[model samples]
Target: MIPLRLKIETDAIEPYVVRLRSFEGISDESHHTGALDAALESASAETAEFSGATGNLRLFGVDPSEVNGDVLFVVPSRGTAHRLIRANSRHNTLLVTERCDQLCLMCSQPPKKQHIDMFPFFETALLLSQKNSTIGISGGEPTLFKSELFDFFNRAMSRRPDIDFHVLTNAQHFDRADLPILRRLDLTRILWGVPVYSSDSDVHDRIVAKPGAYDQVRRSLSLLCEAGAKIELRTVLMKPNAPGLLDLAKFVTTALPFVDSWAIMQLENIGYARQNWDTLFFDSSTGFDIVGKALDFAISRGIDTKLYNFPLCTVPTDYRAFAPSTISDWKRAYVADCADCSLRNECGGFFEWHPKVHGYERFGVA
Candidate 1:
């Protein structure tokens, strides 16, 4: 696993985004004012010195090679730095806010009443992102602050049109009122990942711990489709909604055919999920009949369907091709039994926190 935040000692007082510069010349100097020179040749891997207009700073307890050329958000008061854009990483995500209205049963990032607005810093970080990179915008729910979020998108995309964004939202906030602004944006460059658990309203609402969420999500999705927006319908598979997977697939193909793709995902063992594991964790390793049937049904209807965060071995051979390595590198991991597996490179393995004792029952070479 890779660390996202590292401790640093800097003299600067304000928050600023700076791209680390190695011995080589900077690639795109127009995005930022000055580069923080990263002394990668130093003998110690634990700490390295970085200097810029702000002053010299030491990044302690980290390998210099891992962060060289990465864009970092330095906060002097916290004495910590976040890698907003990694030079070597293909996956980059910016967490917009932590406040959400819905309290889902398996929310990986649990909601908090307090939210610190990071739109300004995120906009600057987006400008410093790598060329033609697809960045992910995730949160408790990004649409909570719809106005500022829209403004951030407009400003960031206007300056960096080459970058594409995949924003994760609950799809409960959008209404007909947001059509004008939504239509004006470049819909082709943005893909909204909206979650729809089940076709049954009672089941969907029960899973999210919100009343009438199913109807609201359907309405919001219709609005998005009318606005010519690209969307990726996301459904996290769990025990509560596992049986209705096929029904949801049928509903998606019949009622929401405009969705660009449908992604069925596994639950991560964190946040609220950790507390509800016994009831929510569905072991698809041995019981993949329902999931496979749903994928087949969606694919037969000409809808692009995929399985996210599922290890290749858990899926049957016929459906293995549909499961890509979708886990982000930072939290993706493998077990000792997988060391000798022939498909380790092609498999997503598991989440770093996936329970080794009571997790997948069937584990072997594919």
Candidate 2:
């Protein structure tokens, strides 16, 4: 697996963001501010020496090839560095906060009561992002810090209008009062990725371990539509919600017609999902009938439907086109069966922690 955080040595006493620059670009004085010259001498082959206004630092035990041109966050006290934006990666996500309102059964990143405000650092990192990149803003729920989040957006978008964001939220905190600020910002560049597991309010609330969550999401969706905000409705396929997929699709088509897209996603084996694997993991390979029918219904009604985190071989030929390689490069992995497969290059494969023993029963070549 590719590492996102690495141990480093630096003289800085406070946290700061820096974009790694090559030897040639480092000498260009215009790029000195908020940029580090990562060029190293041949004598110190293993250690990458970085220099900038912040001060000189050394990143030991890392090949320069892996992190060249990547944006890094230096936390001096922890002696660790986090890759805020990877140049080679097409998908880059900034986790805004760990605090969330609802506790979902199959949550890959479980909720935490404590939250360290990193919106300022994240705003800096977003400014240094690659041109025209769509950075994903995720969290236990980003809307928890609604005021700060909105301020960050307004400030960042004012300077960097070329960039876009795909925010993952539970849709609980949105209200009519937020409409003025939402309207002032460019909604075209923002896509809210909200979750609605089931059409039935009781079942949906039960899955999230929160009563009235479905109702809040409905209200928020209405508010977003009124503000002309773009939305991507996301549903994670699981045992509890599998049977209701078609019904939820119908609900989306009839009631939530303003949705820009609908994503039927596979469950990741991590956090709460790992603990509830047996109960929550739905093998869509064997249960593709229901999933496919739901996709068909949504697509026929003009919804841009997609399958996220699904391997190509597990999907039927007719629906394979809908399953793109949506997994991020850092955590994505492949099994031995994919070694000689013709579509290996195009497949998203699987999450690094996906169970090999009790995984899909029909995993093989497409």
Residue pairs clashing, model 1: none
TM-score of each: 0.95, 0.95
Residue 29's lDDT within candidate 1 is: 48
lDDT by candidate, in order shown: 0.87, 0.88
Worst window of 10 by summed lDDT in candidate 2:
34-43
* Best of the candidates, lDDT: 2
Q: Write the per-residue lDDT of candidate 2 for residues 128-147, one digit (tens) a residue.
A: 77889888999989999999
Q: Candidate 2: list runs displaced more than 4 Å.
A: 24-45
